[model samples]
Target: MQGHGYAQPVKQPPHIAWLVFLRVLFVVIGIFSIGFLTWAMMLRLAIVTRKSLDWGVFVAVLAANILSLVLLATEPGDEIHTAGGNLGITLLLGTLVAAIAYYLAADIRHFHRLHDAFTAHRSMAPAYGYPAAPSPYTATTVPSVPHTPPPMPHTPLSQPPIPAPPQRPAPARIDQVRAELDELSDYLRKQDGHHDGHHEGGR
Candidate 1:
């Protein structure tokens, strides 16, 4: 029987932790009347990562931080104000802190997702110092022939013998042809003489 198998945990890049810490640090710094810095960092990160940025949220946070700073700086020392400026400063500071914290949490989540993507890409890449993978065209195994074939014997090719020219007719056959021609001429001459004698008698 086979034992249960467990999947290995995925590895993450080290920079992701640093990114999270930096974002959290910015949030902490923003608590000291400078929450606009956190918003600006969020906007920069969003642009770098091609993530969406809520401009409305950024404007509101910046405005609240600036107004809170102004109110605190202008407050008269130890004087009770009827304008409810204390409550107003408290509300603005609360809004700024909450917005900065929310953005920091979002940035952390974005960093994690980015890290996961980087991890997946790195895992798929070829490992260092390993032999290259065989090409797909050469992946199939083929058996090598054990013996070298002997070179084929180089035999000279044979050609047909050319025939000799036909022999000329013999001298004896040439004489016979001349004799037959002479006899034919004599017979023609006798026939012509007999025809002339018969024509003279009739005249």
Candidate 2:
């Protein structure tokens, strides 16, 4: 599907002044050790730039600040009297500040690099808010001829007649069977009577 012929405006890179302001803010907050606020700002910058080194520096500074605070609170009486423990705590606080400054510098450099790349990309992209040119070749449709299928061979509807099955003989009636049995019994009785007459004559 074709989109509406209007081109969309290109998005410009973020202003360099904003990044500078963030760096200044990060440095100030790091000097004061403003709890998690410094950590939050540093983390935000790291996330925006997708720079792991920036985040690592922030974490180191945060740890140093916390350690310094702990040392200040837990110093023993003798340790407080001695200059060595006090000097160590001071160094820790200084290290934290230095780490913060380093991270801010790295972040500013990253922003500049990002802005340069983005500007280059935008320059290379096609101009926005303009309609695309029409293609040189125009599409012409050829009229399609309606196709007719070839006629099939005609088959005769009449089939060969099937042969009829052979007929079975009919069964005998019950009255015929009973008449045959009666005839057989009459013959047996005549034979027995003849034998009895012969026996009486002999006696």
Candidate 3:
């Protein structure tokens, strides 16, 4: 949307003043008969004043003009005059009149406003006005945020392995084991001999 009191200025074309003049002239001439001149001028007006051509008006006028031409070619007699050629001419006239009337009614004030602006301020009128571009130098404030430090990374501690239970030590000397075995053998032999001698004496 345009600002409340500001409008973007544009360059006024040199041909606009004369085109407006010629459009009015063609319209005046078209009152007597619908012709190519009027159609062409209306198209020019649409191109100049609107963002796109006024297709609705263009189609309506074209249809009416074609109807008038067809009716003219047939040359119907007086008996059918009320409903034939007269109707065709009336359709063309009505279409042109309505088109012009609508243009003046709907757009006259806007046109006057543009003309006044152009003359007073040397600014051209936009066909369909545009929203003004925002000023590049305008100041905008950024919101402030509280500072927060990043979290520290986690690391696992190294642990020592558990020790196994101690085993019993073997004997240090082979001579001690041999002495104990010889003593056991001598005791067994003495016991057997004593038994044998007692048995023989009893016999």
For candidate 1, write residues 1-203 as lDDT tens digits.
Answer: 98544334445645756776867666676666444454565554556456445555666666766776667667676563735557556756677667776676776676678677767655655453334457998787787779989999999889899999999999999999999999999999999999999999999
Residue by residue across 79-160, what tens digits does model 3's lDDT show? 4355566776666667777767655543454466666766755433232354445587873576668889989888878779
Cα lDDT of candidate 3 equals 0.62
lDDT of 2 by residue, 1-203 (tens): 99767544435557778767867776777667534244655676667767677678668756765676666667677456545558547756667556666666667677677677767656654565444444758544767689999899999899899999986554565567777888888888888898999999999
2 or 3: which has the higher lDDT?
2
Q: Candidate 2: lDDT of 17?
A: 82
lDDT of 1 at 125: 51
In order, how many clashes per candidate? 0, 0, 0
Candidate 2 regions exceeding 4 Å error are 1-11, 34-41, 76-84, 127-203
Q: By TM-score, is 1 or 3 better?
A: 1
Which window of ten consecutive residues has the lowest lDDT sum in model 2? 125-134
Candidate rank order under TM-score:
2, 1, 3
Q: TM-score winner among the candidates?
A: 2
